[model samples]
Target: MDARFLGIPELVEVPDVAVVVDVMRAFTVAAWAFAQGAERIVLAGSPDEALALKARHPGAVALKDGAPAPGFDAVNSPGRLRSVDLGGRTVVQKTTAGTVGALAVKEASLVLCAGFVVAEATARLLRTRGCDGVTFVVTGEDGQADEDLACAQYIARRAAGTETDPAGYLHRAGASRAAAELTQGVRQGVHPDDVALCLELDRFPFALVAAVEEGLMVLRPHAVPSPIEGPSPIDGRPL
Candidate 1:
């Protein structure tokens, strides 16, 4: 069966395998956490729940996000996650949309957390694994589709053995580049550096697959370092 497409917010009712994208940050940060050596990630549905989970996990890093607080660990920046020491530790995260969307898709046969940072490898995985009819859920902002739809369409095209076409994805119904642009525009207003960070393709060789049974997320690194993470970069030095 071929995979179908659905907007991220609509996933609350669907019953199919899902690929969750929050490319601007949430899933990107989650992938970064894994790259930074996090053992597992507990994606919370709300900020309050994340705080509660933090209290329960003791010593586990917690990120509570409620209406854009500046002091708290905002779970929206991949750059922030890069600096943290997640080595063998758990991270409890809440975000404006991504984490909640992941929870919504928890009932799927497989819920994969994805981002444009790992786009190519993720698409390759689907083809290699023969994933059919997977749904691309772009965890949109305020019921509007986010830039995640670009990532989703990129994956879908790859799965269908088609070439990359950003416009094709952006122009489709329920896949609004305008919504994505608005979200990215907001990010630009607050932190332009992050906008660039989120656009870099295939920086991490790993894919963070949602491990529902264990109530955690798992990272699977591709066999080779992504071109972005060239030998010089991984050779204990900058590339």
Candidate 2:
């Protein structure tokens, strides 16, 4: 299958399948939440929409830039996900780029969320789904962030039946100028821990299937063939 990367605005039309990537935080957090038993995540194009969705659900969790909104259960941090119980719960997720980009693709045959955690599972599904082509939407600030681009490239390579040490993708992305900026720490308004969590390749074995439901883009876990690495107390195994 042919795979390519496109920025949000550059995508004039959808392809056979569209995989939206947000390696810096958004998708990475979603993968972790699902791993911890989140039933589904609802993606909103804007914060107002997310709040409105929460209003409809009453107790549903809402997040902004990965942090928990008031009255929400938890934030978007993978680390925080480990401390909470999301089993059978629905998550309302709103982000600056990832969710918005995924929802904007009104014509894609299939939409999936991608990052290093679910990259392997997503690639396998892309190939097995009999898609003629796959487009990876890299949600970059200037429509070009290294981390997002690296994730898209990683998925593209995997779909083509090629190999690249997934860790290498993290190394390159971590050193990128965009990612570098986040490393400045929370004092600078960037959470380094969150960024570190995004780099954990293959940390989960489930891919998120995106679909429009009740006017919201819902992302549900599509389990792979195996349990992957079951989260272990020692080191969070089987990713």
Q: Please provide TM-scores, in order, for all candidate models, with all chains considered together.
A: 0.76, 0.86
The residue pairs in collision within model 1 are 2-133, 3-133, 3-134
Candidate 1, residues 1-239: lDDT per residue as tens digits?
A: 37665665465476666788887577777778777877677887766777777787766777643235543454556655677777777788777777777777777776777877777767766775678778777776643555676778787787677877655543452244533553456443234455556766777765566755465533233433444654322223210
- Please list the residue runs of candidate 1 whose C-alpha ends up more than 4 Å from where it truly belongs after superposition: 66-74, 165-191, 214-239
In the range 17-108, model 2's lDDT, one tens digit per residue, is 89998886788888877776777788877778888888887567777674445655555566556667777777888777888788878467
Query: Model 1's lDDT to the true fold?
Result: 0.64
**Residue 174 alpha-carbon offset, candidate 1, angstroms:** 18
The true-versus-predicted C-alpha distance at residue 226 of model 2, in Å, is 6.2
Alpha-carbon RMSD of each model: 5.8, 4.7
lDDT of each: 0.64, 0.75
Best by lDDT: 2
Q: Can you give the lDDT of residue 176 in candidate 2?
A: 72
